[model samples]
Each structure stands twice: as C-alpha cells, then as structure tokens.
Target chain A: MNDSKFPPNTNRVAEHIVGLPKSGIRDFFELVNAMDDVISLGIGEPDFMTPWHIREASIYALENGHTSYTSNLGLLSLRKEICRYVKSNYAVEYDPVSECIVTVGVSEGLDLLLRAIINPGDEIIYHEPCYVSYAPGIQMAHGIPVVVPTYEKNDFALDPADLKKAITPKSKAILLNFPCNPTGATMPLDKLKEVAQIAIDNDILVIADEIYSELTYEGEHISIASLPGMRERTIFLHGFSKAYAMTGYRIAYACGPVDIIDAMMNIHQYSMLCAPINGQEAALEALRNGKTEMMRMKYEYRDRRNVITKRLNEMGLKCFKPVGAFYVFPNITSSGLSSNEFATRLLNEQNVAVVPGGAFGKCGEGFVRCAYAASIDNIVEAMDRIALFLKR
Target chain B: MKNNILRLLRKNARLSVENIAEQVSSDVATVQKIISELEDENVIRGYQAVIDESKLSELQVKAIIEVHIQPQRDGGFDNIARRLANFAEVNSLYLVSGGYDLQLEVQGESLQEVAGFVSSKLATIEGVTATATHFILKKYKEAGRLFEDGAEYERLKVSP
Candidate 1:
C-alpha cells in the first residue's frame, strides 16, 4: 500500500471527548520529589497495601491458570460474593447473573452508563462540587450536566429544593455519591429517601456511586438502592478498589435493572471484554474475607481524620466536620485568597500539595480539598509547613 | 442625606469612612462599623488592584484536574480532603458524582508546570488512580461578566 493512501484526515476528535490531565496531587508530588525534603498531604488513595490475603488470592488465580477472559458480566463467583456483600453490608440486592456487569473500574462503569442511557440534550442532574468526571462525561455523551451546588455550611449535603430547581423536562437522571470523594460527605438516610422520592416522581434514574460505601465513619452507609422503589430506579456502582486498596487492579461492578445492565454490558463487551481475571478473583476474596482488614483500615483512617480535623481547625481553617469519608473540605474563602491562589502558593512556597475547590465546579471556588491518606508524620509535617506558610 | 452619602460611598471604595460620614451626616464609628460588617460577611470579599499583567507578560494557564479516589476506611474522604485543602496551588476541590471521583482546579504559569504537578505529585498519591486534565481555552464569561462581548464575531467579519 502506498504511504499516505488513507483518506485525508478531516474531522477533529469528537467534540464530546475530553482529555484527562495529570491530577493536582501528582503535580505536587513532582515538586516534592525534586526538592531536598518535602511533605505531601495530597491524593486520596489508601497508603496501605492490598491485604496479603487478597494479593495471595490473585496470585492463586494466576497460578491456577485462571488468566483467560471470564464472562462479560464477570466471574460468577465474584458477582455472587458482591451480591452477598451488598446485601449483608449495604442492604441492597442484585441478581449476579442478569442484573450486574463487571467493569474495568467505577470509571468504566460510569462511562458505560452515560453511553447506554444518555441521548443528545438529555439533562443529567448531579451534585457539585462533584467528582470531576460526571459533567464532562455527560457532555461527552451529549447530555447537559445540571449541577446542584452543595454548601460547605450545610456540611456539603444536598438540598432537595436545589434538586427540584435544577430539574427540567429533559432531565434523565440524578447522580449521587454518598461518602463522596473530596468532601467526604454522606447523605443522611432521610435525605436519601427524599432524593429517591424526587427521582421517582420525576421518573429519573438514580446513578448512585457507592464505591466508598464501606469507608463510612458515622452512621451506617445507606445505599439509595435500598430505599423504597429505588432499587428498580437506581444503578449502583461499587468496586473493590477503595475498600480493598486495589485501585491498581481496576476491578468494579455495576448493578441496575436488566435493561440498563444489558446496555452497559453492550458497551463493556465492545470496549473492554471484562475486568482482569486476577482482579475478579482478588475482589471475590476481599469481599468474602476482608472485613477485618477493612475495619482496621477504617479505624486508622478515623484516627488520621480526627488529628487533621483538629489541627486544621486550630490553624484557623473552617472545616465542616465530615461524617463518613476520609477527606475534609474546608472553606478557604476566609483566607483572603482564591482557592487556586492559596493552593498554588502553598505548594510553591511551603512544598505542600492540595487541590483547589474551583476545579470541581464554579460553586467550589472558595474552598480546597485536603487528603489525609498519608501517615501521621507526613500530615503533621505538612500541617506545620502550612502553619508557617499561613503565618508568612 | 444618608441615602446620597451611601450612594457616593458605594461608587468609590477608596473613599475614607470619615469622608463618607461627613457626607452622610453620620459618625465615623457608624460608617466604620458598616464597612467592617460588609468585609466580615464577604459582601465585599476583598480589595484588589487591577494589575497590568502585560508588563510582566507571565504565562497564564488554567486547567481543570479530575481526580479519582477511594475514601479512607472509617474516616472516608474527609482525612484526604483536609490534607489537600491546605495546599497553596489548589484553588478548589470537589467530591463530584461521576466517572472521576474528585475535581480540582489548578492555576499555573505553564502546561509543563501543571503536568509536572500531576505526574510527580498527584498520580503518586495512594488514593488517586487516574487523572484527566482539561485546559481552559478562553473564558467567555466569568463571574457573570462577558469577556469579549461579541467582539470575536466582529473581528472575524472584518478579517475575512
């Protein structure tokens, strides 16, 4: 074939596709790595390794020659274990065979759902400041992302009134993430009920990302799926990454009505055959026998959460007391700088890393997010540097 | 008299409290107290001098960073968010409800600066699995003010 024989390239990459950038935490780490000495409190991943047993299970799967691709819906054993775990822990039910599909990660599950359900001009109601992908993914799927801005004073809780206001005739779905990422905020059961009622009345689907359901520090983590009439309407996304610290393994699953699951499965079948075979085995093992490890990690996180909350409050940062997640979203508007200005100065001057709130959405401009997944020593050191930086 | 004085002061932030009081027939203490309250409530967030950045010609790059994270066990994302909340470079961070778990706004002088921050700093963290960055092109409207105000169309017409 002649070189340059292919049709001349004309169209730019689809207008909806967005590129992923390096995370702010990664940027901060680069600075830390180059410096003589630095402490970092950025990023929200667990510092602990995947439990030894979970690792061993993956090893066992590999050794037993379970490397081939499993069913598109994922390995039966893992899905069954997920069903048990969800029912026992979250009070939600799913049939492993027909209503669930294994995904590369929650990320992939999100992509699949958006692709499967969204039509051009569909409205996606979501909370903000939210996980970054919801809006962009909606945009890419040719959907409009209507953000319901949660307030820091309200502990980042969603307001039913706001949700009502954001709804329109075109509204297709509402995305909920309890035990949320940056804010570490969880929806109370009553709020979840109210949200469910709203979703039901509006005939909207509820895409609930409960990947962090197991990391709650307060009252029980309530799944929207468990609410009355919500199981039929809500698509639950969960994964072994956060609970098992298996982020690198990229194993997650989604469960909803058969139609939605089938649609998502179509996307999964075309894009990714299945989650890694080893990851599926590891996730199954973790679900079955990792409760103690999960509890231990949760307690350690609680200790770190307490220390950081107290210390930051002492340092003049007004932080909403987080109930479930390990993050603390504080109001930095009082600091006399924009969230971006504060974060940049802190990293450049104090060698500390953090993400600015505005990156989440316009409503998030006044605050910053701090991840305390680091050790006590790193948190303490980073806080001291922050104190000094603030003093200066 | 009071209304007129209030209008005058509203028109000019540089007017001293004493100057406003003199015009309004009020005491300086009263004027000072009102201004103080406004500042405290952040109705007037802060005073700023509009700098001519062209003199320095520094690079102004804005990027949106999407972060995926798992909430820490027991403590959830609170522990992780608080640690990130203190950094200077982070303008804002949000726990969003979609594909990427967290969204962050970062401002830097160059793309390299942002990329460096992401790869060396953010990706290395434990909870963050992947990040996607979107660089802002032109801010058409920010804080409710239109930037170009239909000028681009006019410019294109003239050029063509």
Candidate 2:
C-alpha cells in the first residue's frame, strides 16, 4: 500500500492532455446551437450527402454480412484501389501490400503517422491557419510543433524562405496541407517545388495531407510527394471525406515508403485494428464510381464560391477569390471588430453564423471563414443578411 | 456563359440578375444582356414555378394521352401537333417516337372532363387514328423535387 505510484489526491490526467487547449470555436458554436433560425456557414464539412451508389455499396456489404474487421493494413481490394488512385492522380506509385494502411479518416492517418515517426522533443513544422487537428496531433505524439506563419499577401501559400527558416536539426517532419482549410489557399507549382527542394535539403521527412486535392479549382493539384527524391521522404495522406462527401464514413488511407508505412500500420494494428469494413466497401465503390458525383459537387462549390466571394467583397469585406476548397476567407477588419467579435455580433444581430478566423490560428485573426457549402438560396440569403448587418 | 446562365435560371427562375452574374462569374450588365437576348431568341421560352398540384384542395386530373396520327402530306405531324397544342386542356404536347406520333399531357378539373376531352376532342381530330390515355394517380416527385414528406432538411448549426 505504501508503494503506490502517486499520492491519492494527485491529478490523474497525463501532462500533455492537461496542456492541450480547448478547441477555439467550441464556446462560440455552443452559443450557435442554442439560437433559433441561425443560418450557419461555420461548418467545415461538405453539405452534400454521400452519393447514393456509394452508400448503396456499403448497405449491400452490411446486408451480406461483411461486417467483420478487415486486415490491419485494410482489405486487399481496397488497398489496391488506393494504390491505383494515388498513382493515377498524383503520379506517385505505392505497393498495396506494404505501403498502404487505411485509417479511420485523414484525421486518424495524421495521428498515426505522427505517432510512428515522432520522437520526444522532435519538431514538427507546419503552417498556421491549417486544419485544427495538425498541431494538436503533433503535440499529442510528444512532438514540438513549430509554426510557420503564412500571410494573406502571398494568398497564404507557404513561402519556401519561411520553411527554410523553420527547419532545424530536430525538425523531423514538415506537415503540408495545400489547398488548405480556413484560407482555401493552394500552392502554385513553382512555390511547391521550392518547398520540396527545401525539404530535400533539410533532410526532413514530409507529411502531405491531400484530403482536399480533388476539390482544387484553378489548376491541377501538385503533390510534393511526386517531386524528385520525395517519394522516399513523404507520407501521403488522402481520404474520402471531402472528395466523396463521405465524412461520416471515416475512411482514409496513407501511402509512403515501405518501412514508414509499416511503422504506422504497426501502431494502427494495436490501436485501431483496422478501418471499419463498411467504410472500406463504400470507399471501394467511391473510387470505382464516385467521380461523377464528386466532380459535380466540386463544380457546385466553385459556383457557390464565386457568388459568396463577390457578395462578401461587395459588402466591404476584402475577400480573396480562393481557387480551392469551399470557403471564402474575407478580411473583416473594415468592420472594426476582431474575428470573434464580428462572428458573435453577426450571429446575435443577423441570425447568420460564420466561423471566426482566429479559430484556425492567431495568423487567421481579422478574417472570417465563410463556407459556401450551403445551398445557393441560403448563401444568397445569408449574404443579404450579412450586408444588412454590415450596413448597421 | 449563355448555357450556364440558363441552367441556373432553369433551376431557380427567381434568381436576380446580380445573383446570376455572381454565380456564372459574369457581371450584371452582361448577365442582363444575355438573358434579354435569350428571351428575344426564345432560347428561354418562359419562367414558371414547379408546383406540386396534388397539394391543392380542388380536383386536378392529369392524363398522358398517346396519339397516333396520319402525317399530312405537306405539314407532316406539325399541323395536327399545332392544333393539339392550342387546346387549354393540353399542358404539354410533344411529337414522340415509336408507337405514338404524339404525346399529350392534359390536365382537367375531373376524370370525366379529361376523359371527355380525350374521347370527343383528341380522338376526333381528322388525322388522329388511335389514342391511349393514362391518368396520373399520385406524384412522389416532380421537376427533380421530392413532394410531401421530408422535402426540407436542416443541417447542423456548426461543425469542424
């Protein structure tokens, strides 16, 4: 009894868990949930339901009793499809047997990759105004997250100079999510190449989160993993959530060199065991037949983006015409309000909801992320309401 | 640009010139001009609501009438088709392929009136050789929109 590891009244949670800050948008959205008739543009996921055929495939699978766990690496058929998809789209090849592991989502894939490669105190350099989970994921894995601040002046693309400045001997990996969340910024080819070169020179591993690659609008999405000498140094993460509107299915995959993928899968096998079989079945159907619906949704988002961006700019919010993702990050400083103040007052006054840009990162302050993933009618109505609020 | 504007209008005819311009990535003046030109050219024939007539309290009988017509020597089926198109009961009329030369969607106040129109008016047309009429029972969907149950849904107020 006297050999107990800790005092009776000590805090039970791990130090890292205690250190993590709560989601920046949580309290603001909780207010949103209690409001009536709120037209929300705060959502990060697509408005489209998963297409019928893909859902039908999953139903077909479950009806036929295909509910058991898959191989830790995932069903062979699905892995083969993943390899094929990666090769055809990104111009990078991976062996299905040893170089791929299907995880719960790109979220899980990121977590697994971080856990597999990060040593205690190893630095993970990622850009700010990124997906909410990236920094926290690194920190959870006991890695120090080093932030590289990208600016609106460059359309939020990562400056290679910034990358070079952020790298250190302890910087184990650089996490890149182009056509990024929040800002909807994409890297031009030359800039992407420059960043790739910096990674190669620094001898840093790269984690490319490309879940939104299929949503790219202006031009082709270039994967850093496809660059010379990058195939061995990059872990490529892709998923069905954004592209297929299958966020609820929680299915994604990781592809990289054999040894690293094996390491991630080793952690995955003991923890997650495998991605749900029904999700794999749905993803299989998606890769086979989901292209038409996916493209249709992408074009819809593009149209919505055009209308929302124009409307926001018209109302005196300086909004960038983002060429990727379904968001328009409009600079709201003209309203003389901080991001949270603007979002809160807009919600309270107009019954229209948008995310405060500070929720993404400190660099995201003075802006607000308006998702164009709602119906054109709703978007138009929201824009009118926002205009009224701005006028007031 | 013309097709994109028309597609948006087709889905939602009430969209303002400003809204349409933004959606199609054009300007208001250009969108207004294109729409005016379209209307002048009859590329956009008319704008109307897609009503779910079944919701009305009054009786609304609709029939799909397939007509076999003897094509006129000079006018082909155009003469009879034009005549059929003029009838108030005919909601839509088209020159169809295969077993029928004409397809007519006719609406009337009652089944008797629809039957009377088909039998007395449609079948007695000089070139009409045969007619088959089928009455619509219930509509689960119309104009790409589901009717009745769950026609509208609201998504989560906020999400990550």
- Residue A287, candidate 2: Cα error in Å is 2.3
Off by over 4 Å in 2: A1-9, B68-83, B95-101, B126-129, B151-154
The DockQ scores of all candidates, in the order shown, are 0.01, 0.70
List TM-score (chain A only) for every prediction: 0.93, 0.97
lDDT of 1 by residue, A170-196 (tens): 999999988887788888778778889
Per-model CA lDDT versus the true structure: 0.78, 0.91
Question: Fraction of native contacts in model 2?
Answer: 0.77
lDDT of 1: 0.78
- In the predicted model 2, the residue pairs found to clash are none
Model 2 agreement with the true structure over A155-256: per-residue lDDT tens digits: 899999999998889999999998888889999999988988888888989999988899988878889999999999999999999999999899999999
